[model samples]
Target chain A: MNHLLLLLPLLMPLYGAIFSLFFWRNVELQKVFALQSQVATLVSCILLFMAVEDKGILTTQVGNWPAPYGISLVADMFSCIILLAGSVTGFAVFMFSLQGLDFPRQAYGYYPLMLFLQLGVSGACLAGDLFNMFVWFEVLLICCFVLITLGGSRPQLEGSIKYVTINFLASSFLLAGIGIMYGLVGTLNLAEMALLVRILEGHESLITMAGMFFLVALGVKAAVFPLFFWLPASYHTPPIAISAFLAGLVTKVGVYALVRLFTLIFVLDTELTQLLLSVIAGLTMFIGVVGAAAQTDFRKILSFHIVSQIGYMIMGLAFFTPYAIAGLIFFMVHNILVKTNLFLISGVVARHYNSFALKDLGGVYLKQPFLALLFAISAFSLAGIPPLSGFWGKYMLAKAGLELKAYALVGVSLLVSLLTLFSMTKIWNEVFWKKKPDETEVALLSPITNRMLHMPVVMLVLFILFISLYAEPLVHLAYRAAIQLLDSDIYIRAVLYQ
Target chain B: MRTIILSIAIRLLIPLFLFFSLYILFRGHNHPGGGFIGGLIGSIGFIFHAMVHGPQHTVNTFFRINFYGYQHQPTQSRSIYLMRMMRVNRWRKRKRHYLERRNRNRGLLHIEPIDLIAAGLFVATTSGMLGLFLQEPFMTARWVSFYLPFLGRLGTPLLFDTGVYLLVMGIVLKITFVMAEE
Candidate 1:
């Protein structure tokens, strides 16, 4: 039964991709298949949550292969929370993609690629082996390459070349790191690696080098500070729906992988790695929000914020405590929903105003009051204002940081939160609250395009509200996840000895 | 007079290069020389042939005529050998027709050997890349047994080399195709 739960999310997407490919020309069939797969994945995730509520950790060997020799897929608290969050955002993105565009016929390829990508993400979250994680990352990366270049326009091509090149380099580093780790430990399994590291606790240099390689590789993927230039340059060129989905989920996956691996496999050198991570995290938040403040393009600003928000998640890990890690999980879940919704709302604003540049977009409230309200709510949630999902995540993280006596990081995080609010207000004042532009500006806008766009925005808005209202159950789930993550013995025993 | 001299030079150099490439392909398992280098050499051979005889004449000699007795079975491991031979025959015919048309229209002065070389380079590079993947799971060595001309085991190194050769040849042909359109 536990194995079935682990396999269901992945199988749904794989089956969906196969079914959609056979009916490529039938858009309605494709949409139905995509939606059904997402719903199935979400339902399966809920069931997995229930089963693991008290069990603590579940391990299943994929393909019925025994542990160590066969690939193992393990879901402790951390991965399960991420999988649930990923499914929610993935479902919203699928709905948005269905309704959003005058997508060309060639885009029949998109649904299959999207499903394949989800399969990769699910596999990545559940994978207990390092090489298996790399394989899943490659699968997702290849699909992203196809999706980003789907339209094959000049901008898409240019952006994709950079995207592919940078990511390819990152992949090589990941492969090299895995090779080195394997050479050193003689095992690729995460649980096995963790046990080995603990046994050889004083081998500081080898562990640090491995950790650094991972940091660089995952940093590029996560768009963490200093490696974030590609995010703003390339993310905006994809179609708005694709951009939203990507903006919502992709980087967070990297952060999830980083948290899982560092917490489980490399905890021995925590003092050294966590200090370096804390410094980087502080800079990541500072630099990200500053970049956001400097941007005039709506998507570009949001893209910058992704970099900044990753800082918060890294900070949770840097604190190296269960409560902080729990806060990170909660924060990641909130951010994915809120960010995707905000980007989708930007899509709507672009539809009404003819541009994502602040100079051209104005008075959204005058035209669409409800849209403005929804945007404001999401923006504030992102800013970590009280009574929202974001606030709880920030509160717990700050509390954890203070407990750890990492006062400077706590201060930086607080300041970054305020700056985040300031930028959100700037966007609100420029795009939503300002007076409507003159007749000439109104004439420049496209005709009221696709009312269907509102469906995704509504779905995401309700998701955010649901999390805010039912914070207790989710917070408790996060606490359990955090506990499971810190307790390495459970993971090692399950995957290695089960 | 200049064209004849160029043709003679290419004729002298092409076969030696092709022989060296074959040597590399066969010995790749224990050494660095593999399918990629060998395929590149093969592409160079075709390119030199085009340069010396002129593309039209080369196409007529190599590609234009149908080569009888060539049968391709989709499931057969040795199908690639048949495909290569057919491709060579087609090239010969095309060369022959091209030379005839050029003689009638432009008196041979309009043909360019550099175009042929560029076309060859393109084919060689692409085919080499494709050839690299013919071996399954990539970078893993395997021994394949065949029953043709009695029985023998061929290593993946040879298969990879053949893939490289084909890739190079295909790329060169494609480049020429594009250039001709331009």
Candidate 2:
């Protein structure tokens, strides 16, 4: 029964995707069925989280195979946390797709594809072995390829080609990394490798070589510094709902992998890795914000900011303090919700104005103040304003940084936050506060679309508020998860000796 | 494209190819042959038939679902408007001749490749869940108490292999026909 609980999140979405294919004739039924599956997944996510909270950590060695040999599905606090946030945002994005996405794309297996994407995500999150996680990422990538090019517009085709090429490169890097790690460690299982890394004693350099392979591969996925060029170029080309989904969760999976490995398997030489990661984090922040400042498009700016916010999470991981790691987890969840909401809001802006360019968008403040307020809450949260979720995350990290006495890196983060605010304000001034453009026609939104677009954003806003207002429980949870991560024995024991 | 000798030869060879594919599919699990190779062989049989007779004719005989895809919208004006768009190359004009042939040949049974994919996924998932019903973890193989006369030790793994077979066959045929249509 316990193992079943862990499997529900993956199974629900997989079943949903399969069944949605059966209902290809009726798009409306497909929509309802997909929503039902997502709801089931969300329920399962809650159950899994509760179970993890109660039982400490849940691992099922698949088929009763001995540890390190068979596929294992494990859910620790961190994965459950990521799963919870992902399901909520996934549910909202599914709702938004009903109205936000155009009809033809919906008919072209969009709902099923979305469900498959969810399966990939939960699979990646829950997987206990490195190779299994890589397989899940491939599943996730295939869905993205089709979703990105569903319309087959010229831009969509061009963007998807770029997206595919870069991701394939990343996947190869990851596979090679996995091969090397397996060769060096003789095991692909996380817990087993953690134990082996401690025992091997002499091959620290080769291990770090494998770690470098992962860093570059996951760097591309996470859209870090030099490797992030594909993101802004392609992310803005997809439909807003798809963009929001990808922007919100996909890159973060890369970060999740980094945290998992660096803290667990790649800890052989933390001194050098820490310095290297902090520098990368700092440069990623600076370069991302600088790029966002240059973009005048609504979704484009948000895409660039995705890269920037990731740097903050990476910084949190680099510090390796319990508080910093806790902040990293907290910040990851906070960023997912806030970033997805902002993109959905951008979709609303694009729908009404028919343009993403800042100059052509305006008068939402005067015309649709409700939309403006929804936009304000999320955008402001993203900018790390006080009393919002982003602020708490930043506060935790900065406090951790201060405790570490990393003053220069701390100063760099604070400056990056300020520049983030500048970019958000730029969007605010141009998209909402300015007068409506004189020349372009404004598209009217039907009541259903109006409801569909705002419902998800509003739900996410409530979530952001919930997190900010009721901070202690989640904070405690993240703190405990952080402790669990740093003390790797608990995980190894749960998987190997349980 | 059809030649009388090739068409007659395909008429005799296709059934043999299909029979060998099923034999190969059943031979999977303990041996090397399995769903993927079996499906490839099955698709090869059809491909040969398609090359000799016609793709439309081959599709109509086996599948009981629509294979004609979403309508290709006439983009006469839009294509011109798109700066990057170019006219369909004349070298690909043979694609149109097949399209015209597709309209003329109507089969009573026609299955879309996507339908096969969906059905295959469903079957594979169901087979995995069967282990769950038996109180085993997902994708764990569950065999019957008694063996079948030919396919010995009927099990969820075999069901899973069948699903993969259909899935692979569907994928290859879909790509082949769609490309052949265009």
Candidate 3:
């Protein structure tokens, strides 16, 4: 029963995707199934998190093959927390997609694809095998490619080509890394490999090489400093519903992989890894923020912000402290909600003007003050203003950095936060404060869409507020997940030793 | 492209291809051939027919199945909003929607190739769920205790392979139809 509970979150989406696919001819019926499945997946995720909290770590072997041989699905506190957060975002995005995506796109298997993407995400989080995780990544990659290029518009094609090509390269690097790891460890089970890695003592160099491969591979996906050009170029090209979901989860999944690899399998060379991560984190934050500052498009700014905020999470991982990891966990969940909310909010704004350019948008405050309020709540949280989710994550990271005496990276992070605020303010000024641009018309959203769009944003805003008000429980949960992540023995014993 | 000899050959070979494909699919679990290979082989028959008879003719003849008409055609200016004419817009939309829905209600039922993919996914997931019922983890191979005369032990793996077969067939058909469309 407990084993089934561990597998439920991943299976729910699979079931839902299949169920939705059965109604492919009827878009309305598919939508209903898609939403129902999303809610079901979300509920199961909540259930899984609660189960993990109550039972510590839950591991299940697919096909009764047993650990080390069968494909193992394990839900540690970290994966549970991420899964829970991801499902919430998935639900919200699907809701937004209902009215946010164009009809043509909706008719073209959007809901099923979204469900498949969710399945990939949950599978990636819960997968306890290296090859399994890679397969999930491939699932996400294919889904994202189709979703991004669904319309096959000129710009969508251009952006998708870049997105697909870069990610294909990343996938190769991932495959090569997994191949090397399998060669070295003679097994693909992550927990068993963790145990073997410790026993193999002198192969630290080879292990680090494989680890570097992961860093680069996941870095491209994560949109770190040097590999993030495809993000801003492509993210703004797709429909808001699609972009919002991608912005919310895709890169974060990469960061999650990096953190998991470092804490679990690649702990032998902490100093070297820490040094390299800190540098990448610093540059990613600085460059990503600087890029955001230069963007005129609403989605483009948010896209750059995704890269910048990822730096903070990686910085949390680099410190190699439990407190820091806890902070990373909290920060990641916060980022997913706040960032997705901001993108959804941008979707709302873009719908009004039919443009993402800040210059082409204005008078939203005059037209709909409620939406302005919604945008402010998410934007402020994203900028790390006090009393919101982002502030807590940033505060924890800065404090943890100070404790570790890593003043340089801490300072870079602080400066980036300030610049993030600047970009957010720029958006506020141009989009809401200024007069309407003369050339652009205020395209009215349908009443049904108006209701649907606001519903998800308001829902996410409440979530942000809940996180803000009840920071203690989440902080504590993050700490617990951090403890689980740092101790690979717990994972190993649960999987292999039973 | 529709030469007499080639077309006739394709017509004759299609049955042979289909039979061989099913032969491969059933033999796949024990031997080297399985659902994926079987699906590819099965699709080859259609592809060959398409090459000789033209994609349109093959689609009209070979691909026709259950009716699934009444697609919710998007309303004109469905996304546009005008504040001043709000009530008028709503009323007009309501009437237009009713008329269009009724008109489209009588249209032909034509299921597209994408639906097969959905069916494929459904089958694969069902195969995985077979394990859970028996207190096993998902995707666990469950087999019948007794064997039949011609068929070997029946199990979820074979079901899973069939799912793959449908999925591959669907994807190939969809891609071919799309690329071959006017």
Candidate 4:
């Protein structure tokens, strides 16, 4: 039963991808299969959470091989929370794709690629081995390359070229890092690596170099400051549904990996790596928000903000304390829901006004009050307004920073929050409150776009509201996750000795 | 007429280069030379030949080596061949008309070695590097044995080397075909 719970989420998506590809000619069946598989995966995640709520940690050795020789799937508080968030957001995006899509014939491949990406995300979160994590990251990246280029327009191809090239370079760095680590330590299991790292604490410089390599690679993937040019150039070129999905989850996976590795394997070299991360985080937030301020396009602004929010998550990890790490986890969850919702709402606005440029769109709130309200809620939540999901995340992080006496970082974080609010309001005034453009020609929109756009808005808003109202359990979960991460012995024992 | 001799010289050199590449790939596990270097060497061989003999001749040679029957009697394998033909025809027709109208006074520039080299490097580098990067990152030393008559034991390193070689070759051939039509 334990093993079944471990395999269900992965197998469901794998089967769905295959099913969709084989039955590609039948579009309706493909949608049904994709949605059903996503729901099943989500349900499986919930079940696994319930089953392992009290258990210390769950590990399943795939193919019945020993720890270092075989692939292992792990479930801890951190992975379970990430998996749950991935599934819920993935399901919402799947529904949005079904309804909001305008070019189904060309997008026949999108569903399968999305399922494969989900498989990769789940696998990455659950993987206990270094090589397996690399494999899963590639799986997710390849699918993203395809999805980003699905429309094959000039902008799509250009964006894809940049996206693929940078991601490919990042993968090379990841491979090099893994190879060097394996060559030095003679092991590929992350837990084993953690043990070996502790045993070789005298050789801290080597480990620090390896940590830098992994950080840079994962940083590129997460859209960190210096390596973030590819993100804003490409993220807005994908179909709205793809944009929403990626905006919600992809970079967060990188942050998750960074947190996992630093907290577990490279804990010995924290000061050096953390200091570098702190400086990078500061620059990343400031630069990203400023870029967002300069952007006139709605989606582009949100895309730039993804880079900024990732800075906050990285800042939390840089603090390297239980409270700070817990705050990072909660903040990540909040950002995913709020960011994805904003992108989807932009899609709806685009549908109504036929433009994503802030200069071209206006006065949408006059007609669609529900959408306007949803947009306002998501934007405020993103800005960390009081009693919202983002507020708790920011408050906790600020508190954690204060405890660590990182006064400047806390101040910068607060300043970034105000800037975030300012930009969100800028989007609001341009997109919803201002006067509508005088265009005598109104292009008829499909019913699919109208219905599909609302699902993500409703689903994500409810998620934001739920997290705001019921922050206790989730916050507790985050604290437990942070504690488990800080105490590497539990993770090592679960993966190696269990 | 002199160009034909140069083409023959290049053709002869290709086999020698291929042999050296194979040697490098096999001994790469213990030394510096590996699949990536070997694939580049093999691609360089084909590219040199294409530079002297032209893209059509190069493609013809490729089809002969592979015995990919569709390239010889394209209409017979209509489904896949038709797609290939469509792409080739469209490219040629468009380029021919454009060049005829744009540069009627000057004759067409003969294919240059530098162009082939550029295309070859792009093809060989991307394909060779991507093959290695896409595989198991840390387990390059793990060997899998397969019994064969000539080679006593073949391993993953050799298999990956061969894969890189094929990828480089395919990419060069495809690029040559596309560039020729224009």
Candidate 5:
């Protein structure tokens, strides 16, 4: 029963995508089907979490095969928590996509591809083997490629090409790393490999090398530091729906993979790797925020901020303490929701104002105060204002860093948070508070009803407020997930035994 | 522009391709052949036909034969036939309604080759769900060892393979058709 529950999230999307294809002509049915599937996924994830809460960790071998020989699906607290967050984001994005995506693109199999992408994400999070993780990533990436290029506009094509090329390179790096690990350890199952890594002697350097490959691959995906160029170039070109979904989920999956790999399988040479990660974390935070300050485009600024937020998550991982990991977990869930909401709000603004350029956009506060409020809530939450979801994550991370006496990294994190606020303020001022351009013919664009556009954003904003006012349960869950992550033995034993 | 030799050769080869595809699909029951390869081969038949006779003709013939066939038989009195049919079957209204809705959709948007892909996917997913009733996990293979007079050992995997075959072919057909259209 638990095994079926574990498979439900992944399979729901798979079947949804398959069946959605059959309903291509009836776009309404397709949208409802996709939305229902996402809702079902959300419920299953909740159920999985409840089960995990009761059972400690749930593991299932596909085709009734035992672990080590068959593909395994394991959901510890960490995986279940992330899957839950992902499904929530998925549901929100599907709601947004229904009215947000243009007709031609929607007709081009948008919902099916989105479901396929969700399948990839769910599979990646729950995959108990390195090879399966890679395959899942490929599935996720392939769907993204099609989604990004769905419209076949010049800019979309250009962006997709860059996105595809860099991602392909990253996949190669991941595969190379997986191949090396398999060669060295003679096993692909993560639990078996973790056991092997502990028992095997004299292969620390090789293991570290493989770990480096995984880092580089995931770093590119997470858009950390130098590898982040492809993100801003490509993310702003797709339809706002696709951009919002990608912004919310894609890079976070990278962070999830990074944290998973480092904490679970690649624990060797931690001092050196952790030190290196801290440096990257500091750099990633600083560079991302600074870059955001220079962007005038709404989605582009959010894209840069995505890089910065990732840095904070990595910082949590870098601290390598259970507290920091807990913080990272909280930060990831918060960022995914907040970031997706911001992008969706941006889409609404772009639709109304007929521009993504902040310079042309103005008087949003005067005209649509509610949209402005939604943006402010998400943007401020993103910048770590007190009592909001982001604040708790940052607080946990900062305290964790201070405990480790990593003052420089802690200072950088604080500085980055401040700069993130500056960037958000820049957007708030330019896009919302500034005067509308006189020459712009806002009347030329047909009026889109606020209900379809604002519904998802409003729901997300309410969610942010809820998480903020009631952070205790979430914080506790993150803490528990972190503890489970730190104690790798329990995860291994669960997978092996069950 | 019609090349007699090329057209003739394609006509002969199309059936052979289809025959080979069926052979491959049946062989997939035990051997390496399956729905995917069969679908590929079958699609190749249509693709070849398109290349020889043009995609427009291929599409017209295919749709005409499969989607819309003559419903009312040619009679000395059309009114009498219609009245008799209407009186004979009250359930015909639902069928007529379905056809009307389908025809309306067809007028709204010409069905693209991608529709085939979607149908193929639907089939694949349905076949995979056959195990759901047995408390097995999704897509879990359930086999039945029954011997036929001519064939042997049928199972759910064959259904799955057929689904895969159709899906792959549909996808390839959609892609190739779109490219050709452009």
Candidate 6:
């Protein structure tokens, strides 16, 4: 029963993709089926989360094979919560896509590709071994390739080619790292590999080299400072629905992988590595918001903000404490919700204004006060205003940093929050408060599309509000996940049954 | 642009290529040849046919389905292979031409590439669900070892393989046909 729960989240989307592809020509059927399957995926992940919460870290070996010999699907608290976040965002994005994805793209297999991407994500989260994680990452990258290139527009193609090229390089590095690690440790199962790395006598420096390789690979995916060029270039070019989905979920998966491997597999040379990561985290945070501050386009700004927020999550991991890890978890989940919602709302605004450039967008506040309100709620939450989800996350991380006497990083975090708020206000002023452009025409969405768009945004906002108001459960969950992450012995035992 | 020898070679090789693809598909259950490669081989046959005769001729030769109904009628004038396969005598040339023209106008077969995809996916999913019904994880390898009269022992994995084979073939054909048209 437990194994099936772990498999269900991945399989539901796989089957959904296959089934939706089978009915490729029937766009309406595909839409309905895709949404239904996403909901089903959400339900299954919730069930899996419950199971994980009740039973500490569940591991299921595929084909009844013993762990360390065959592929295994394991769910600890961290992976399960992330999976839950993936499913929720997936559901909201599919709902948004129904109205947001235009007809030609829908006909061109968007739904199937989205489901495949979700499958890759869930699989990546649940994978119990190193090679399997790499495979899942490839699957995830391939789906992104197709989704980004679906329209065949020149910009889409240009962006996706860059996206694919960089990601392929990252994948090669990841593969090389896995190869070196396997050579050094003699096993690919993460649990067994951890044990082997600890006991293996020689080649300590070589293992550290492999660990650096993994960091660089994941760093590219997570859009950290120097490696983040591909994200802002590519993210804004895709359609709003695709952009929203990818913005919310994809890079975060990379961060999740980084946190997992760093916490569990690469525990050697902790102080030095943590120092290196802390520096990167600070740079990532500062550079991302600085880039965002310079952006005029709404989605482009959000894309850069994603990079900045990733810095915060990495900062939590770099602190190398249980409180910090828990804060990272809380911050990651919160960012997924708020970031995707912000992008979705931007899409809605674009739908009305007929432009993503902030210079051309205005009078939204006068025309639709409710839309303005929705934007403020999510935008403020993202900027770490108090009593919101982002504030709680930032608070926890800042508290942890202060306790560790990382005064520099804590100050950097505070400065980034202020810059983030400045950018959000800039957007608010330019896009909403400014007078309408005289020549530009603002179109109203069809009642159905309006309803569809509004539902997901409202639901996500309510969810964030709920997380803010009643954050105790989420904080507790994060704490437990953090403990499990810091004490890798629990993970090893759960997977290896030792 | 038709070369008589080239056309004849294509006509003769079509059956051989198709047979080879089937062989590859069947062998995929145990050996390395499986759905993806078999589908590629089959698509190579159609691609050759398209190159030799022209995309329009290939489209007329193959049938397709859209959301509504059959996309093309498989008949003598439209289907070049069907026209050549007929055994009309010289004495009945005029009447044969009329009949062939009429056959061209008639809908002899209504098959579409999408049907293969839909059927293949359905079958593959069903085979996977069989494991689920048996209270095993999805796509679990379960075999029935009983020998049949002619086909021998069959396993669920083979069923899954066949489904993939059909789906890949359908997809290849669909993509090749669309690309060949323009």
Among all candidates shown, the one with the greatest lDDT: 2
lDDT of 4 by residue, B13-132 (tens): 989998888777766766777766876777677777666666655644543322111354734666777777677657655675464455333322322332333333333323223323
TM-score of the A chain in candidate 5: the value is: 0.98
Write model 1 residue lDDT over B60-138, tens digit each, in one string. 4444433433455667668686777678667755775564665433321232332333333333323323322442211
What is the C-alpha lDDT profile of model 3 across A1-498, one tens digit per residue? 865786677777777777777666679998888978899899988888888899889989998898999999988999888888899999999999988888999998899899899988998998999999999999988999999999999989999999999999999999999999999999999999999999997899999999999999999998898888788879888898999999999999999888888999999998999999999999999999999999898888999999999899989999988889999999999999989999999998888787778888888888889999988988999999989889999999999999999999999999999999999999999998888878555777778879998999999999999998899999999999998888888989988988
Better of 1 and 5 by TM-score: 5
Candidate with more favorable, higher TM-score: 5 or 6: 5
Model 6, A16-76: lDDT tens per residue?
8877876766788888789878988999999999999998998877655688987888999
Query: How well does each candidate superpose onto the true structure, as a TM-score?
Result: 0.74, 0.92, 0.92, 0.75, 0.91, 0.90
Candidate 5 structure quality by residue, lDDT tens digits, A337-447: 999999999998888778899889999899889888898889889999998889999999999999999999999999999999998999999888988875576633334
True contacts kept of each: 0.00, 0.49, 0.70, 0.00, 0.40, 0.19
Question: Residue A340 of model 3: what lDDT?
Answer: 92
lDDT of 2 by residue, B97-173 (tens): 56546554342344567779888888877887865776767777777899788787888889999999988988888
The TM-score between candidate 1 and the true structure equals 0.74
Cα-based lDDT at residue A482, candidate 3: 95
Tell me the lDDT of candidate 4: 0.81
Clash pairs, candidate 6, are none
- What TM-score would candidate 3 get against the native? 0.92
Q: Candidate 2, after superposition: displacement of residue A207 in Å?
A: 0.8
- What is candidate 3's local distance difference test score? 0.87
Please give the range of 10 consecutive residues that has the lowest summed lDDT in model 6 chain A. Answer: A436-445
Roughly what TM-score does model 5 have, to 2 decimal places?
A: 0.91
Ranked candidates, highest TM-score first: 2, 3, 5, 6, 4, 1
Write down the TM-score for model 2: 0.92
Candidate 1 wrong stretches, greater than 4 Å: A105-108, A440-451, B1-182
